[model samples]
Target: MEKLEEQIAHLTRTVEDLSDVVARQDQEIALLTRRVALLLEREASREAEGTGGVVLGDERPPHY
Candidate 1:
């Protein structure tokens, strides 16, 4: 029937749209995962080098 066909078409379009959204989200997640890994590596290296000290409140600057 025409009504059934119309419903099928609508559903198919909705599914395709959802698929696109999911693909985009997958790419974004992958990029963020890579960035997090890089940052972790950098932090680890900094720790190993014994640099990157944390300054507390009321502490004088190292340049002082």
Candidate 2:
């Protein structure tokens, strides 16, 4: 009976640890989803303004 109790305790602890890991991952995924949505909105607004081309560092403008 004592051996059975020990096994049950270990299994419970393992399950709790896994639950914590899953909760943390869920929060991270939610944050990333929000950031992606914001970026898409910003890109859409830029396109609407007719500035679709992005100028990189030391890059010449299209008119140059």
Q: Top model by lDDT, which number?
A: 1
lDDT of 1 by residue, 1-64 (tens): 9999999999999999999999999999999999999999999999999996888999999899
**Worst window of 10 by summed lDDT in candidate 2:** 46-55
Estimate the lDDT of model 2: 0.96
Model 1 C-alpha lDDT versus the unseen true structure: 0.96
Clashing pairs in 2: none
Candidate 1 runs further than 4 Å off? 56-58, 62-64
Which candidate number would show the highest TM-score if scored against the true structure?
Answer: 1
lDDT of 1 at 27: 100
On residues 7-42, what C-alpha lDDT tens digit does candidate 2 reach at each position? 999999999999999999999999999999999999
